[model samples]
Target: MRLSGRAALAVGLAGAVLAPVTPAFAAPPPVTADLRADVDRNGRVDITGTGDQTGEDTWSAGRGAVFLPNIDDDAKRCRTTGPDGKPLSDAKLAKCNDAADTTVNGAADAKDLARLRTVPMAQAPKDASGTVRVTGKGAKHARLFIKRAGGWTAVTAKTTLTAAELRAGVELGLEGTDVVRDRAVWDGSAVVELKVTAGSTTTSDKVTLHVAPLLTQHHLQRAQRMLVTEIQGKGPFSRAQQKFVKDLDTQAKKAGVKQSTVKFTKYGDIWAQDFVEPAYAGMTGEDGRPRTIRIMLRSAQPDREAGRELFEKLRGPDMGVVQVTGVKDSEEWTLNSMGNLETIPPYTHGGRSYPAGRIIMGERKDTGSKPAKAMRTLLASQGLQNPLFLDTSWLHVGHVDEFVQFLPAPGTPRGWRIGVADPDAGMKLLRDAKAAGHGKTKMFSVKGFEGMPAPKETIDQTLADKKLRADNALAAKRIKANLEVLKRETGVTDAEIVRVPALFTRGTDEGVAADRMPLLRRIGGSADTPEAVREYGQQRELGKPTGPSVMTSAYVPGAVNGVLLGPDRYLAPRQWGPVIGGKDIFTQAVTAAYRKAGFKVSYIDDYYTYHLGMGEVHCGTNTLRDTTKPWWRP
Candidate 1:
């Protein structure tokens, strides 16, 4: 009956479809002023920027408009908060100046102000002054900024503008990145109105605010730039990790995407993609082109302080990095959130086309341990991606990127296909290699790390291990279960799926350590434990469906979990399968699969770096793509 903004925005994050545009509250109160903005792509804020001259009342007929919240400048460190507003180190000051931002409730930078769409009130007679006001339940969380010679001033509810101030500029901004504030997730819907009177003439105009969905993925493959951590720390594996960064630069150049490397001199966290994801929000303007903004979303689980500082390092023009955190530390299990959350490419499913695709995360069907609630709520509030929950409780790391990925398939119905792990195919590949007389060839014949020697086993020996074989069989079964969920949700059939060669083994003697278990679990008992490591008393009592100790891991680098370079290039983790003659049989299989699907495969050696850490190329790098496509319908 009523368009309750709070109730509508608070819908369940799992298996929930957010309405792209929340309709105006049933029969809004009559507007009393003239508050104009560039609602149309005509390059000017005027009355003609609408389907009809009824102003915001005609929003349903034509309401394609939006503005960035502008909180991304908080990317770098608090350099301005230093002594005398100066940093101790000159280099640190330089870094801060590059991304120099304002206070939390301060004015926007020059670039940010430019990108912020204009909010101009109707011009009044020569000496006439007026007051511009914004109201509605959605107005509380956003600020209506007014510009002056000193700086831009922020007003939340309402403000009076002198004739000169009105002419200077007036704009709106979000107080913070998250749509879900302490109370409600505010969908950008505020009625802006202005009252002006002169020579016995009083008039007004009103319009509705347009909100843009902060989106990620498939679009990220269209990244203008790519980034990976520069692991400068000295270690036995440092050289190999540095080589990995070089490899990323090489691939980026080949793909024509700019490569950015951050000095991880302190943290040495080479898993760049895990800490942050690339996203964007914008609206088309009068020039028949998109007014784009580059953004990065830092993961909710701030396990690494380096990640937060890294956000400050990554901030640039029209670009910002943000993290929506909770009041307290997120559950340790939520560490999987960033890696688990990924997007499927644009596709039509069940007679509907998702031009911007869907948001997916690795979550259990019955179990409740997942990403932070605030993080999920913020994502779902965007509305473009109807987020889905896939079962990944079977994994040791519990990430979706480990086993499943989306590829550009021009020939497929949706112009894309899902690449998923197939343990059976892996076994078949090994069996075929052995049958070809390479059974005696060493499987991991090369040293994975500098000090550690390669596993002293041949293909024949590995195949002989009944437990290893059984591990793969069970892994394949679980993969299929998640695949079925994907099929049902995305309308993807077997024809649209690509089977990737993958082997599995129980990695650690105890799969998930007692420390990694989810918080608030009753396990073999019925009491909620809110702390991380204290949740599970004994590792064997972990309430995992695959028994207590089965933490399935990729026996070799899984090819599906690789970095995607758009227009047909893929960077897969180098498969260290048995080398027969000049080529590795496993490498040959992986290459053939991707090559057949119209993508050229480049092997990235992660054995010493990420593979040893139970990750691959995709886990090590993050991409920012071209996402200016209009997500709203006519």
Candidate 2:
């Protein structure tokens, strides 16, 4: 990968040949004026032709342009505030990677400067002076910086700066002022060119640049640091949650991955992966080092600054944080949350394989619940992972991850296979255990776990509940339909997919539509207190038609929602299952299923912490995987 452009002066640059762009003026202006951007995104600007050639002038997928993201790549301590008296500057949320503030002393930092291309005058007359500007629909939204004196200084469009040395060259860097708000609003396109006039002649070269696409994911996890929220208190999070942290720490350390914990107890949602997308743009520097960015999802879950908070904590070197928000108070709000997001590992279907794999998110079947227009547009624009959707409307939490997971399978032909919830399989496992004379075994039978009361019911009593049976049956039907969708999209055979033993139970309409949803809510009192949620899903409520007739939560914390330590090591939430002879039947079944897929599994007891809270181990912890793979290669 090398950046190629035209019109390099005789500065004795060895590699590329001298190719001057055609001057617009009739008379030769004492020198040929040329502006070279990284038209070919190999990381450096190499002059390849004499004039308007493909790689030098145009931008395309493989080798035509440069890619930079609308990300927050620079910051510092500034005790200032925006309109809302928050803090003046959080260097993290602030995307303006420039020096100083106001309209005065701001200059582009060195790292941010390197992220973009440098449009320099290759070979111009020493006296040759001209004006440079950005043109196109998004021209004004981008800033042009001139490298002079000490550092890079931001210059307005068509700004005439200091004279060129005409010996080496003059460097002018281009930086994106904002992210792609929406495809309809701005499409990330701009052209930086130069018009130098010396005596009578003037010439220019235009190279188009597309704001970088957010690259998708692969199965191989090279964890830099594993993240888990550590909040132990009386309110929402309990001692069980702390125990979950300890368990995850043990697992992470065993896998040779470092683990970090978030001490902030503001938000109740412990799913770190939901707020912070472990994302990377797959763009390399001039030295071939890969750049990664954590694109925080602009989620609207009570606290609006969920984006800002995650950005502040997670942003670091080469890893910037970007938040593309959406229409407030709409389906775009909850649907765009990262809990609903999952990446289908690289697979071939109908002879076509996605190199970056495909991004899969949940959407409503009856009344569509998709991501924000800006987010959907940005995700689709990535080109590698063509996003596909499934009907997660039936889920009370409404996330694809609850039922589906893509695990790395080295023994398989595709190198990965689907690990999905099988309600029927779960029911069968229960029946089988019962048939083996374990029908009277009591469940939720762990000794000293804190939080919700362990349901003191036998397997016989659980199977006898009409409501529970109906709910799991509904879940089974829905899971089958979802599986069909997955099978059609990615050419995975039934044999290749592993069926996890998982069950579901319906929750009330009141719980689903609450301000702070997805809680480990269990109403006290009544014969079957926890199971007695006033179920409502069929009808349209408050003009937002929730199409699914039955919406349900995991009766047994869906084992499919487990986290991966690596391709071969898996961490699953412990099923506080009924003991038969010596082991929990549910735990044994879950372990067996994963082992069949070539994964060594260890169970983390998330019963009181995440299971009761409508989540599991994967929800409580997030991994920043090694996504430095070739964006264009499978």
Candidate 3:
């Protein structure tokens, strides 16, 4: 039962005053004692005390007290009825008498009940197979007490010390065959008080215990290492791709950055960053060292096999691997770590709190309501108070990195700013390039088409240009809609969003006649056949039927999909231009925009494989960063 401060005080005072007190005299020689408490290798607190004294002694223990001030009047002892059926009004009188008794006994005053120093206590260490050793000297007898929600209780079953081993001038072990063996008192922190009295002289000592936590995952500091994978020459990587890798390595070396490159196998595993999540904990490893654990997500079979390979190659006693089950795709795990918070997609069951507490997820209008509700419930059950959910279904690839990114910005009002892709801004640059006589090139004029028939020399390119413009306009509208949703959900103003120029494009379908011509080598038979000329003439009349396409970024690798190397450095995809009437305008504008926001931009070419596969540089790499702040504070 819970007790009011006054009620607790009344009860304590009643016991102390009613007990008999021996007559006071000149204090005997001061007792000398030493106390030590240590946790050993057994997850137990082994306490011992040793001291010396002369003559017969009396041993006692005083428990620590917790008092609450300004208690309700109705709960005060003075306002309550006593056993005599009368209102108890002797609280002040009892305190005065108790103070007199303390003065008579030559002990510390008991007038102020709130500031009593009874016994010291500490939290136990949470490490496995560890023990706490507590020793005390200069005391003849020792008593141990553990604090709980109700109050302090003696470590031994009996209140009085009856064993000779527990008497003064002897080394006493508090827990073992001779002492209490209950596991309850050993769980939390304990307070041990040793008191020895010789010929009316008494001395006491107290010591506290503390235990450290085993796991912690709420810190996101500077990145310590950049992780990449070899291309293995499996996909179509041009010389530009090779140059991009060389440039990246050169820059990294110049910065003295450490890197880990996973050897590429024949298996299709180019994106190393999207598979795992690194979480730090305070537990000792098998080799008695502390480190982080890599929590990998397995989606498809190939991806799972690749993840297992990495895990087996890198796993250690300190650096372990944990697999997250039932994930829809690896893209769902592409999260932004923000110290105590992580931005991820809602795709898991309830009760799993990853990367610490707070989570920011996105909601798609296309996903059914029941699934969304279940995901929300799962997140809430994991103690995520207010998760930020954005609408990302408008884009062809519904991933947050395709549109938004968070980076360190010391100069901004907040320490960081969110970068959002702006297709409208990209279209504006394209329009300016077209006005300067850049967008007049026909689709048939594009290089690397051996079998396609030559386009009519007199054909006008205006319709093709208009179709491209229409695609960009549609992309701009979708991007605007997503921005509105982000602003409404995140409460981040437009001023805070750094608009990066980017665009999107739809994949070409093979069934369409226009789509098939670009990939075909010849429409009819060989040059020897007479029908070849006639077939070519007829094909010209079909005339690139207003191109079937969708909304895609102007740049092949989206601008927003770039990776932030650090607070001041960013690595983006290199855009080859002069395709949309804009010769390198997309790259130039993107570089200028990032530079204006206090970041030095480095362009890395990914056109051959990564861009073609609908990804960017950030999607292909991962980083291990140091955590600067504590999760509890944020």
TM-scores of the candidates are 0.78, 0.82, 0.52
Off by over 4 Å in 1: 1-33, 41-44, 49-62, 74-81, 84-129, 146-185, 198-203, 285-288, 327-337, 351-353, 512-548
CA shift at 618, candidate 1, in angstroms? 1.1
- Candidate 2's residue-wise lDDT over 34-151, tens digit each? 5666554556655446332355555555555544553543444322356687753434355443322312123323434433322344555556676677787757566667767766
Candidate 1 has its poorest 10 consecutive residues by lDDT at 529-538
Writing each residue's lDDT as its tens digit, candidate 1 over 493-612 gives 899888889998774444432322221122213222112212211122233333235657677888888888766888899998888888887888898888888888888887656665
In candidate 2, how many Å is residue 316 off? Answer: 4.9
Instruction: Rank the models by lDDT, top first.
Output: 2, 1, 3
* RMSD to the hidden true structure, all candidates: 14.4, 8.8, 21.7
| lDDT agreement with native, every candidate | 0.62, 0.63, 0.40
Which lDDT tens digits does candidate 3 get at residues 356-475?
333444434444211123223323432322355555434433445667777666654444566878767766765666566655543222233233343432113432455555656776
Q: What is the model-wide C-alpha lDDT for candidate 2? A: 0.63
The model with the greater lDDT, 1 or 2, is: 2
* Stretches of candidate 2 exceeding 4 Å from the true structure: 1-30, 48-53, 73-75, 78-108, 114-127, 161-167, 216-218, 232-237, 300-308, 316-319, 330-334, 351-353, 381-384, 411-413, 448-452, 512-545
